[model samples]
Target: MDTNTKAFIGESATTFATEIGIVIRNDCPMNFHKWDLIPEAMKTILYEKLEGKFQLLRTNKAFMKYVDGRLHAQWVRTRGALSRHWKENGGKTYPQRARLQVHSNCWSQDDWDHVCDYWELEKPRVSMLIIFYK
Candidate 1:
């Protein structure tokens, strides 16, 4: 795909992942460990979001893969940012209320808490570390 298309897809995926964290917070299992396991409803919403801007994603496996990668990258980044924020502010020992700061403007406190809960799982922490180091 062209650079413009690639950039658009990446930006759209990030926006959807951050803005629609509520859909993910509600639809996904708290133990969710992988991006590929995202609920079909969430995936459909993303497809719909992208289709409005770029139709080729529907038929193009390569573009679809790129979108998936972008989504995963955003997920990782969001998780990392929250983790870092929590640590920098005061580690887990701090009161939950004090650590309830929203990681993004789009995320509500509940959404932030839910996503933080997901990252708290061992599977996600290990998987994220592997990806981060690689």
Candidate 2:
């Protein structure tokens, strides 16, 4: 695998998934812990807006995985959590892009520029899926 791919789905991270549903949270606190601060005020409310438009599912499965072979969990799935949220709360607002930053020591300007282009061209539009290869 390339160094760039290792960054998103950690090489060793195990992934657990099923068509019924997938839970992304794993043993490492890095993911869940960081997500803890996501403001509950917006949780149930925001999903409501995304319904019909998309589904946020938390699963161990992804299009790709890192070297270690672990799958991370996701918070929502299609017609899943967010779809349900909007039904409850139809009044809410959303941000255009969700910015995520990471520090790396290997990538050059060209590599990063390419990654940015990929993010916009592919990843989901709601959260701005970004991949910065290290």
Candidate 3:
């Protein structure tokens, strides 16, 4: 991938991870330590807020794995549409575009700060998603 596309991915991943962390912190605090224990309402909100708009199931799955403490799991799919775009584009960058996808279920910056303060945890990092390059 070109530098720009790589950078976009990095930035998006960070934002996506942050958003997911905030969701978990807000919706499933009672079960934060155990993803499987999260209630259906929490899972539904998370799925709609994250995957529904981004169409990145693999990336969402990776975040879930991270939350579950399953280390070194693949976060994004290498054999998927995103990968095909990179391979077919001859190392060029994707067309510059902005997607303003948001949902009512999202948390505000203040809420995120509260989560950090309450949980004594740091902000999410892009490194949490271990890309499995094939």
Candidate 4:
């Protein structure tokens, strides 16, 4: 990649890590109360973090993997808080609990197409398009 792209990814990754730490610290209590909302909340935070820069990293595979690794590591760091919440709620830790948390569903080809459509936003190449539309 070029220097600018490299710098952007590096800065974004650093910001993502810092934000994850702050989120875990401040939101642990709310998370404990609403276990089912965790995934959706995380997705929203990630989308917010990538808002202005999504066009930069959208087609970059290496950047995608870097982002995934950062999120996985942060999830690991916050596991203690999750476990504590479960324990306090009389939810015992078990192998099945982890499995249940990561439930997977089989999607048809059409569903996969929909997901791709949702993620792959194409920016207009011409300013005239924006000017005329706006």
> Which candidate comes out best when scored by TM-score?
1
Q: Count residue pairs with overlapping backbones in model 1.
A: 0
Give lDDT tens digits, candidate 3, residues 1-134.
12333222566666655665555444533313334545667656656666543453345554454433421111122113222433343212322110122112324444323322333343344656678998
The weakest ten consecutive residues by lDDT in model 2 span 94-103
Task: Show model 2 residue runs off by greater than 4 Å.
Answer: 1-67, 70-106, 123-134
Model 3 vs. true fold: TM: 0.32
After superposition on all C-alphas, the RMSD of every candidate to the true structure, in Å, is 7.3, 18.9, 17.8, 17.9
Model 3 misplacement above 4 A? 1-8, 31-33, 58-134
lDDT of 2 at 70: 26
Candidate 4, residue 60: the lDDT equals 63
Which runs in model 1 stand beyond 4 Å of their true positions?
Answer: 3-33, 118-134
User: What tens digits encode model 1's per-residue C-alpha lDDT throughout 44-79?
Assistant: 775565555455455666767766665566555545
Q: Which ten residues in a row have the lowest lDDT in candidate 3?
A: 70-79
For model 4, the superposed segments whose C-alpha errors exceed 4 Å read 1-14, 22-45, 52-56, 84-134
lDDT of candidates 1 onward, in order: 0.55, 0.30, 0.39, 0.44
Candidate 4's residue-wise lDDT over 1-134, tens digit each? 34544424467556656765554444332322233445756655654555544443646667666555555566555554544433443333343343233211212334323322322332335755445553
> How do all models score by TM-score?
0.57, 0.19, 0.32, 0.36
Error of 3 at 123 (Å): 30
Give the TM-score comparing model 4 with the true structure, all chains together: 0.36
Shift of residue 25 alpha carbon in model 2, Å: 22
